[model samples]
Target chain A: ATERPEALLLVMPTDHAIPDVDAFRAAVAAGVPRAVAGQIVTFGVRPDRPETGYGWIEVRGAPVDGVAQRVERFVEKPELARAEAMLAEGRYLWNAGIFLVSAKTLVAAVTAHAPDLIEPVGEAVAEARGDLDFLRLSEGPWSGVRDISIDFAVMEKAANIEVIPLGTAWSDLGDWNAVWRENGGGIVTQGAVTAIDCEGSLLRSEVGGQHVVGIGLQDLVVVAMPDAVLVADRARSQDVKTAVAQLKAKAVRQAEVFPRDHRPWGWFETLALADRFQVKRIVVKPGAALSLQSHVHRAEHWIVVSGTAQVTVGEDVKLLTENQSVYVPLGAVHRLANPGKVPVVLIEVQTGAYLGEDDIIRYEDIYARGDEQGPKR
Target chain B: ATERPEALLLVMPTDHAIPDVDAFRAAVAAGVPRAVAGQIVTFGVRPDRPETGYGWIEVRGAPVDGVAQRVERFVEKPELARAEAMLAEGRYLWNAGIFLVSAKTLVAAVTAHAPDLIEPVGEAVAEARGDLDFLRLSEGPWSGVRDISIDFAVMEKAANIEVIPLGTAWSDLGDWNAVWRENGGGIVTQGAVTAIDCEGSLLRSEVGGQHVVGIGLQDLVVVAMPDAVLVADRARSQDVKTAVAQLKAKAVRQAEVFPRDHRPWGWFETLALADRFQVKRIVVKPGAALSLQSHVHRAEHWIVVSGTAQVTVGEDVKLLTENQSVYVPLGAVHRLANPGKVPVVLIEVQTGAYLGEDDIIRYEDIYARGDEQGPKR
Candidate 1:
């Protein structure tokens, strides 16, 4: 493996809220020396409540900000009574999972603890190809890597790991209750929503053209997305995972799949779908192009709404501005490209007898896709 | 006035839930003779709870099914204490406002009490013109008529007004609370919805392709429609009218206007809209046709998904079936007629520089409209 052994890596969860960036930076800077000395520094937070949801790090000394302390042991998420007893004992800190470690230390820890993951993960990383601004990881080897958290695989089992307390307001936003706490336990709202007589609630309408209204709601969470919705008690936000599991069991598309189809050329969403026709609002990123493809059953009519598009229909390629249209007959090889510096937005109407997402014939794909059909576009 | 003097009229509210149709019909049959004898019979229901939202009728005797008794007075919606007292008194019945009266008596009572409204209402009805299956009342005269409920304008002051107890369970469904009660106070839902750990709540999704999910909701009302959503405390469903008033004061179209545009041809709802393009799902009833129309700023592409449509573009006319499409050029006269024995469903995509609703030039309308702009389609 061509590892950056000397480079320091900071681990942060994506869905987290850290309000005081300066304090986090200070703690990270303070832990850099211990990381440079080949020690794994895991950040912890002083427990403000007997939170049963998080793991606890029992430190040898009191955990303090900007100073690493010796770890006694890492405790799994405890029962409520045990969490309360630990909170009262005053030696336990939340395992925030934020880590700063040198690449060599991480590699050595993983090799010593979980040697089986080394070969497949490295192969997956090495085989990944660049697609536009993102890296399309090699799926073959990646699928073989066990779905395990880094903490269990390397952190908890490794020696020379210290804990540093974060001196900042932080929340993982792991659930709706966490989000509610992050918003100061008040009625939090976003998007086109109207709340009346609601207390300690969060109402969000994340999709366009959908309005969410909450009335006489208390300690409830209502989130409206395009294809799915989540309405739950703030206290039961953790149970949403169970609901998601149930949805996945039923093979619902909205269980885990996002509403919009993301491709290397930006994204597209179906505005409307019927038995014989479908309408989509497609956005192509600046300088990005769709696959040179054609459909066997569907004919498409594309009308540009904003920016400009380089449209290919059969042997002809032309530029289409706002309000300009192009027709691609069935089986006519076509493509759409954004040549301008802004995103190209267009509406596509596909008329067909058999309209499924698998009816596409891709002659070439810039994203390195093979004959795998997409949206039958 | 040309009065059908002997006609016996039974008043049934559009919003009421009279689940037992035979019970309602039997009550009507019993009241028919009283109504024919010129005694105004107002139906009353036995109170199931101390509901303060309903008006009450103080009858001279114990109310019984299928028998008319003298009405002492009509008490307006009362406060909690008064409604509770009335519920215990056993002589009070809900003034259901379902009246049975002869046309001559109704006309005479209105002429004696609300005489100012008689001329305008009579003229409006007299001048109403037939448009399709509906009669379009003369707007000028109708607007001049005073807005008053029949109970206030005629029944409350009329002598010999009798209260007949209805032998059935019924609900006006005047508010969301009433709907919740009608649904038996459990988790009531309609359309695509999921309720988790919810009790005493109503969750509904009235629009197509919209999903509603609720969790841990109690004593709440959530209604999702195409343009507006109502979420409120089940206890304070009455305050929803205040929210509506607020929206009206702010000139929000969703406050009072419907999202669908209803015309003689059938109806159409906007599937999507943007600055330069709009998509609509239009359904035309069998044998119905749109006007010969053209838009100055937009061109339309119509793709039929169901039935058959006789489409006229400029001077060319063709019959299109499922999966067939036609392009209507800007400034070219076109019409869509459903000639088949079923509704013709089509998706219309409009491309334009300005996509306003009033951009139409109507040449001829079978529904008898003059030069007035419509979806500017």
Candidate 2:
């Protein structure tokens, strides 16, 4: 409802690599006049290949000013031979999903073609709540809206649609191969990666102190994380989702979570896990506090390595600075807070017969997650 | 000298993979009698392929009792065509280097062919010093001896020679391919390894918590260690030594040393190393003690996690059990000893401007290595 221009630009999520920004901008400018005149203008790219992944736009005639043309029809992804025939016909363009329309025109089109979506979306937007800096939509109205794209809802059936063709180097970086291609081919390596006799491969190590060695590899992708690793053929990079699915089916925690747990206070990572003891490097953000909690089965030894920590153990409270340490006996209710302007980093060593995170009983939590256990912090 | 049988056996480093111990033992037993009769008998294996990697032993005649035969000569590794011809002729066997001879006969052979070696070797053995239970050879005479193998010094020119063909499954295990063959085929993996569409490959990870993933890899070798990794084609596995040589030329510590340093007392591994700080997990065997030492630039905090430690700090001596810790300030002489039957395991956190092992000066050491630094323990 704020004061602005009458028209709006809707950029749909069509994964693309647009190399010629000037040409793209010029093409969009050509459609701005038409859009302002109440026409919905969709930008398209000249089909260099018979791509089976993108939809096509058929123009009614050649562009009036060699920039924009009237739209004849919108077509779904076509078969390879039919796509080639359309390409030979020289009237089809690959849909890039870039749209420009007047706000009133878009509302009119949606009201005419898809009346069922407006009420729920409007209600969801009206009932949205402010969460910190994010606006959270009302779940009831949002979930009630039908799951459909704008193409099926209004764009395909709208009259007064115009099409503009853009010629530029574009690619959809949908997989590792696409990324490799975007990187200008050859071996793409990062971190502690050593590649010998490797071509058209991507080898990356995201974990510190981890090394990846690739030898005589062609068209392959290797990604090494701290807690998990992935190796996939370059052509089969899209199938990496299958690995995620398999890991999820197996109920592996690494499938959906990382070794370092992020929290409102800060972050902590388990350095080592053993049968009777566990070691973690905990970092608390400035002016952040942890829950007042106690563990029945564990005793903790905290060594402050950086900044300052205000620790409360039992009825005693003390501030520990760098190079100092404190011990918390078993069952002692303790809390750690960073009160300084810098982060407080400490090494926490927990020893017990049963050191499961479920052994904790939270008394108070500022983040309102007292019932959450096992790495909520 | 002690009174015993005169005959002796010498097992050269053949790098063999003998599958049938009974058959090998019987083959050696057959040669024992001939060796006792003063003939220098060398066991050979019948050629199964035209292997160009091993030397060939020519037999003078067929095995008298399907076991032992007179040896004609030993030939060096031949060209592929020559090896094929020899394999087809059926009179040659691979030189297994398994020798059985009477001690007096071996002495006579050495006297005849390598006269200069016997005197120096004998003097070196005679002047060997008894170090604990190990006999340390006198460096003076040992260094003066010629660097020649027994084959070139004696067996190649000996007057009395014999060969016993051993028809058993044996592999030299000279490379990864040989190891893969010995492992009975496709995708041999150890530790935490996941293979997807991999064939005829060897993937091994020696470090705990390390995982190796292979995808669509054919005839490749991947070995992951704590501090280094190696990946090579299976056919080029022998060239892994070349990689080691290159690493050595670059003066990489991982080329020759492992992350865990072993000592006479026990072992210790660096858990983490950072600027001006280091963490080590040290294990001390029962009845073992570290040298009384002091570091000019470092302070140490030792936390005993297992067993008991007898710690001496300056003038005070204290016994610390599990869950107890002690701090040694910089320049304070200290010693740690394991007095319990089990090993004393402790986490040592070192903090200093200079945390190098060379920063320490030892006052007293029961192992008699006071001047040694850098993990001599």
- Highest DockQ model number: 1
lDDT of 1 by residue, A1-377 (tens): 25568899998888888888999999999999999998999998888888989989998766667889878888888999999999998889898878999988888999999999999989988989988888977888999999999988888888889988898877878898887778777899988777777899888887666666666778888887666667788888998887777667766556756668888898988787667788899999999999898889988888777889999998899999876778788899999999899999998888888767788888877777764334533
Chain B TM (all candidates): 0.94, 0.82
lDDT of 2 by residue, A1-377 (tens): 22444847666555678988898788778888888898998888777788765789998765333377778888898898988988888888888887888888887888899999889988998988653335767778999999999999998998888888776666777677778878878999887777777788898877555566676777888777666666667877766666666667766666677778877789887666666767777899998899899988888878777799999999999999876778888899999999999999887777778876678888998766674335454
Give the distance in Å from residue A172's predicted Cα in candidate 1 to where it truly belongs. 2.4
Candidate 1, superposed: residue stretches over 4 Å from native = A1-3, A79-92, A294-299, A312-319, A327-334, A339-341, A351-355, A371-377, B1-5, B79-90, B294-297, B312-318, B328-334, B352-354, B371-377
* Collision pairs in model 1: A215-B232, A231-B215
Expressed as tens digits, the lDDT of each residue in B215-283 for candidate 1 is 677887878777666677889888888777766776666676577888878999888876778999899
- TM-score attained by model 1: 0.90
C-alpha RMSD values across all candidates = 3.2, 5.8
**In model 2, how large is the Cα lDDT of residue B69?**
74
**Which stretches of candidate 2 lie above 4 Å from their native place?**
A1-174, A353-359, A373-375, B1-19, B27-43, B53-56, B62-79, B95-167, B205-207, B273-279, B294-301, B313-316, B327-332, B349-359, B373-377
Residue A341, candidate 2: Cα error in Å is 2.7
Name the candidate that leads on lDDT: 1
The weakest ten consecutive residues by lDDT in model 1 chain A span A368-377
Clashes of each: 2, 1
Worst 10 residues of 2 chain B by lDDT: B1-10
